[model samples]
Target: MTEQLPDTISRLYADPGEYVDSDHPAVEAFARAAVPSDASARDKARRLYTAVRDGIRYNPYVSMRSPESYRASSVLAAGNGYCVGKAALYAAACRVHGIPARVGFADVRNHLTTEKLRQSMGSDLFTWHGFTEVFVDGAWRKATPTFNDTLCAKLGVKPLDFDGHADALLHPFDGEGRAYMQYVNDHGSYHDVPAKFLMREMAREYANMQGEDLAGRDMEREATEQ
Candidate 1:
């Protein structure tokens, strides 16, 4: 039997913040469009998961220097973002509809990276890979909406799907059944994205890869530059 969650636990997941701005118009609109007013909690969770998974383009090269980039409303307005930004948007969207959600982070080794991005990062190790942990059906289910369907098609990887009752995590193997991403370190979960903590780790881990001047560097350019 599923254990009952206390009110405090639910509140923790629904709490809003600078990063998880559930009250923002953008987030509210996002939630409403994804989830129908008459839908059940499970159906709402599923729709929201799919909306976030495919709606926003996944570009791992967004700037981490600005705090605005990490905000859920900002990510929604931009229409594209990295894993962390997308995760924040998903969590915020969930919270806006009174569904409990939180952000989760871990370091991963991506085995299938584009040539440009792989070279730019100088390593396969990706720090602070983000996903959403949504409380649904008396439990928390994880989903990674980092890779959009278009990108998945391009990369030949199967798109991740969420059903609300199951964990929608990254596939251990790709479409060809080859090894994909591997999680190395889990930084646990939070109600909001910890920008300073994440940025510090990114700056430290990707300093050389990001170039000498991380503050002024445009990460998108680095990912695109041959």
Candidate 2:
């Protein structure tokens, strides 16, 4: 039986925010094409999770200076984005199908990162790492679709998958038992991408990240080289 969603929860699927523009034509079409319309909520969420996860190449080198970088439709059109943008895309896609979803943020110490990226940020601690909180089966399940399967394979870590029932967070250890990602703190969830606030926090945290156009840099190639 489908559980009754409260007004607050229902509102999550309503208006299309500046970033999470679910009502956009392209986003709606993408969501509809990802799964059959008659699929269960869990099935829909699961399909959407994988669609955004692998469909969008995870590229951390992209510039965060523009507000358009964080917008879901723009991210989808670009074919690549960082964690936050991918999360926003997933949330927007889910909302297109009436699945209540929100973007969640956290600070993680990533052990398996490119040396160039680490130097660029001056630290391995990634702030505002984004994931999606999907409401399924009367509970909010966390899904981290940031690292695609191909990248995880190259990094020697298991690909994060969503079962639509459990939280799909990053693994703390790699296949060889080496330390991987350590979640330091969580910044809670939001209905839409807090673009300005995230950019401000990112600028404050990563001194070298602001206003830099890092296009054409292949993060996957860097990972393979490392």
Q: Top model by lDDT, which number? A: 2
Clashes of each: 0, 0
Worst 10 residues of 2 by lDDT: 207-216
Candidate 1 global CA lDDT score? 0.82
Show pairs that collide, candidate 1.
none
Whole-model lDDT, model 2: 0.89
Clashes of 1: 0
Which candidate tops TM-score?
2
| TM-score of every candidate | 0.91, 0.94
What's the TM for model 1?
Answer: 0.91
In model 1, how large is the Cα lDDT of residue 129?
91
Per-candidate RMSD, Å: 2.9, 1.9
Q: Model 2, range 31-121, lDDT digits (tens) per residue?
A: 9999999999999999999999999999998777778779999999999999999999999999998888889999999997888788788
Clashing pairs in 2: none
Q: lDDT scores for all predictions?
A: 0.82, 0.89
Q: What residue runs in model 2 are displaced by over 4 Å at the alpha carbon? A: 1-4, 211-213
